[model samples]
Target: MIAIRSSVAQLALLFLAAAGNGALFVIILRLRFVMEQHLKWLEQTYPAGHVSARGEQWYNRPFLVRSLFQFMLFLAAFLSLILLIATAWTHRGEVFGTMPQDPALTYYEEHAARLADGYETLSLETAHPALLKLIDEHFEGETLAILDVGAGTGRDASWFAAHGHRIVAVEPSEAMQTIGKHLHPSPDIEWRLDSLPELADTSASGETFDLIVLSAVWMHVKPDDRQQALETLVSLLKPGGRIYLTLRIGPSEPERGIYRVSEEALNTQLAELSLEAKKLDEQSDLLGRSNIHWVSIGICAATD
Candidate 1:
């Protein structure tokens, strides 16, 4: 809304801003330094400039200009925040149960349901190369049975069958599973009418699996029951087997700027259970605007 620049940076930025006419600016050139110990070389390397920044770098700019602009931007943002707060206070009761439904996920689940309909054409489980590799390499003929925790349409189950593996898929939405089976045709994937937080009570799912997978479904869970949901998912995995999870683990308000999982805290939580974890893979898009952080399979065995 408004600009904030440091005093020294402010003066320089003003000049730059005038030149840019609100179109451009430049900042520091971050250098990544590495030490090659054996060769006894301390090598330093830096990119010439920021991705879009041009002209002199931030640290080299005038003090007052930088400060003024920095202060101005802050003030503008604060004013915007005030407006938002005022609006919220005026409409406090209206925010509850009125938060927008997540249309993106609805779209995703819908697609999954469609895939299930193409049961012969789409196998959700072994369809993804990454997931299938785990099945073939890690649990080959090892008594490992899989449970697709949020198995929307049973594509995963069908894939497991297509690959000669037995499987169970749990989908709470009846319409989705019905469409899924319609696509799959034959009774390949064992479908269950349950959801996360379902108990180990015999009256519940009534059984377990060698591996459990909860992929891209955590964020859809109601906030208060998420932990219980996690516990239930974990319980579904046999003590010596594993659980594969994929969730949004980044900045709390990533839409604003950036964030990542708390490394140490996530580790500590894993240490408390009968499981051990390793990050097996990672993928980034457009310089990590958003990333898919993969936590490798977590294995649990009985505590000695």
Candidate 2:
């Protein structure tokens, strides 16, 4: 089927991209080593009088050989990047830029009041007990830099900020961000317009956080973007910092209109992202949605 082919193509392109980036990084390190070696060779030959007349002539000859070597190194890196771009072009259907805006954004924008009414009280107090326990055990007395992705109406971010943690709340929907700003007017919470797969502004800041929370947000990310979103979140974490994720299970609701996510898939992706799981718990929906289940996972970067 065409769908199956497209999936395969997308996966292949992802692999190519990973390999190309790795190759480029290795080549750059090698390039640096080559430069050091060339400089050392020049010093030994020109100043140390270690060469015969013919050898000195060769050593002092035009810098064409070094230039050629440098050119070849750059050419290899260029070719690998070109290959990555070509692979991306061939699988453009799943490209993040080409995907449509998440329907959940529209849903939340249209029904912000309904969502707020139903979930406003849901914060660290009402969170899954296991996750709360983990938070208490690990971050007992430390003030943290917290990142709340898809921080709907600033419910959780408000709690963290109130508890003396600095917070960055990211929400792409203007409606939700506006409501959050109005509802939770806290100087500790910095509001930013950003979203997953790439948190451009956050990434640009070059600051990592001590805690990152994604409460019922990952499902909005498409399957192709899941890995990248995880990677981005992990990159934003300081070493030994934790990420608490709450995944809503079961079918996608017509109102939410987001992709379905599985616990198995999440664990697999977390392993691929090199995150170490501290705890994982499945619980019935606390909001009295009978049709819904939740998976709460606590994970962190491995520390030596």
Alpha-carbon shift of residue 147 in model 1 (angstroms) = 1.1
Q: Model 2: number of clashes?
A: 0
lDDT of 1: 0.52
Badly placed stretches (over 4 Å) of model 2 are: 1-99, 302-304
What TM-score does structure 2 among the candidates reach? 0.65
lDDT on C-alpha atoms for all candidate structures? 0.52, 0.78
Q: Candidate 1 has what TM-score?
A: 0.49
Evaluate candidate 1 by giving its C-alpha RMSD to the native, one decimal.
23.9
**Tens-digit lDDT string for candidate 1 (105-200):** 334443654544444453343234455565566687665577877676665666666766667777765567777677564455787766655534
lDDT comparing candidate 2 with the true structure: 0.78
